[model samples]
Target: MKSGEACLHRLVDKWLAPATVLSVRVVRSGRMPAQRARFVYIEAIAPSGSRGMFFFRHQDGCWRVFPPHDARPSLCVDALAA
Candidate 1:
């Protein structure tokens, strides 16, 4: 299995233990313009008939849970240069 899939399985296991995973699907995938990072939105269903969604982001060459923070424009001032 791919590393990302394995990581996802681990995450699901950690969060939803005792609940059998029925299905997993990638709802969306794309690069975040701000961070220029790849991300995947997933939807999972458990045998207990509960559904959950999560966002997995690719960062530092690893798949991690939660999307990266949005980048906001900020002003930078150089007092020495002024």
Candidate 2:
């Protein structure tokens, strides 16, 4: 995985483990109009039936997770190892 994806993987593994991840969906994604940075909006669901959304922006060769513009979650839980 790329460095950005690797960051997300570590985050998910560190905090979201033990819970089965149901899905991860991209809500929005694109590059900055006048910059090299890229942004992505993502949503995730868990087997427990909880769901949330988050935003990520790529900068300095890394991906940083941020709180959504709205009230959705800032941390997205990816698939946890079964």
Candidate 3:
């Protein structure tokens, strides 16, 4: 994994540990137009059978999980299809 991916790994370890990584599907990914950001979509399923799409942004050598303003969930699928 690259540094950007490493940041995501750290995030997984921070928030989603004590759980197993059942699967991860990279639905979409690309560089941001006119910006220092890269977007990635993840279709993740945990060992407990939970599923969701996580939207992440890699910008300026850091990945902070996207849409930090939302209180509902840190991840969703709409971004993956964007």
Clashing pairs in 2: none
lDDT for each candidate structure: 0.66, 0.54, 0.58
lDDT by residue (tens digit), candidate 2, 26-64: 667776565545666555667676544443554444455
Error of 1 at 10 (Å): 2.6
Error of 2 at 62 (Å): 0.9
TM-score of each: 0.53, 0.45, 0.47
Q: Candidate 1: deviation at residue 5, Å?
A: 12
lDDT score of model 2?
0.54
TM accuracy, model 2: 0.45
Better of 1 and 3 by TM-score: 1
lDDT winner among the candidates? 1
Q: Between candidates 2 and 3, name the one with more favorable lDDT.
A: 3
lDDT of 2 at 31: 69
TM-score of 3: 0.47
lDDT by residue (tens digit), candidate 1, 8-64: 666756664444677776778788787888877666677667555565556555566
lDDT computed for candidate 3: 0.58
- What tens-digit string does per-residue lDDT give for candidate 3 at 1-82? 4654647667655544445867666678776564536666655667677554454564345566663332243677898999
Clashing pairs in 3: none
